[model samples]
Target: MSYDTEHVRNPGGAPERITGIPTFTELLANVDLASLYTDIYLSTATTGPELAETADVSKKTAYEYLRKLERAGLVSETGDSDGTRSYEATAFEMTFTVSDVEVSITPELVVVIAHADEFPVIERVLEERGLVTFALAYDLVVAHSEGNVTVRQLATLTDLSSGTAYDIVEAIYEIADLGDDDAGPTTYSPNDVADEPTDLLEELTDE
Candidate 1:
């Protein structure tokens, strides 16, 4: 899967879209919160009870998390004809720019964060390396999936040991398999960004 370069950079001008770093970080750290958010995100629309059943939590727990998600701008609530309230995930894109490089967190990344407990390597990467590196790792995993980079090159680019890089690759494969119900994982490549420095280009080009 791939995203339009411009759409990913700006997402959209939607007022409901979330772009704050703090909010993104807060959501990323909580597995249950992330799970509830993803269920809404990947669904057409769902209610608190449905979310609780799908996420294997109680109704009260689901509504509580739904409120938190609504407050964070990750999900929006709508009323049903029977006076029941349904929730849907909102459009969101969290992006950070450093110098000339920018990384936007994708929905697939959020799914991975939600299921991080199932993959120790991925969990470790997020816990130790933080969000930026985790985003870069996702890109690197996509590059590897497309045969654009090898594990050794991934290690060089990420500054991770080869063993850890390989583990991440395996973990990503598992995550992608688990996401068969949702949109397949998409990627953004730094190479797609034009006029980057010669040395940076050379590094990408290097064996």
Candidate 2:
């Protein structure tokens, strides 16, 4: 079956300006070689062979680019299957001041490490729900506040499949050390804790 190449590249224009985090534009400016790193992260995975093909490069070229990303501490190689390697992006952190409130952000870039120039729906998922939820999670932790937005709500609002929404929710729960309160069904509460994700990524890659 033939698939459209641009299918994932169209994440509906640039992501909306995040309230207290850098936009992709700001990231590209402040983080050296941002575009190259983003390109490599998005394209190096097994699913997006066409990215390398379209770039007129060999798999070796893609690997080399990914290697650079590794050295820069931006991505880490996961594992190999049938001689093809997998990779996961490192978490990206930034600080911004909005409305006189200084905020810090550490978000999963979730840029479809395998699919490169596609991930249209996934990117949409990130824009509408994931990034904002990251910020909200952090904010809630800082303010010592509580609220509930169920996985079903997220699934419906973001148009993500239930499984995808569960994946995202589980990741967030794991990262934040969050757990459910009054659980007949699961509802999550952010913990008063902070973690550096380096060790976590290493553990994940090792597995």
Best by lDDT: 1
lDDT of 2 by residue, 1-207 (tens): 333354334445654433422233333232223434555455445322433444435667655554555665666666777776666656666556666544454433322212212433333444555445434433332222233345544444445666665555545444344565432224333342233243432342255
Q: What's the distance in Å from true for residue 32, model 1? A: 1.4
Residue 144, model 2: lDDT of 25
For residues 53-168, could you state the per-residue lDDT of candidate 1 as single tens digits?
88757778877888777877778886675877788888877677866678787767888788877878878988788777888888777777776666666666777877788788
- The local lDDT score (0 to 100) that residue 142 gets in candidate 1 is 77
- Candidate 2 TM-score, true structure as reference: 0.29
RMSD of each: 8.6, 16.8
lDDT scores of the candidates, listed in order: 0.72, 0.44
Return the number of clashes found in candidate 2: 4
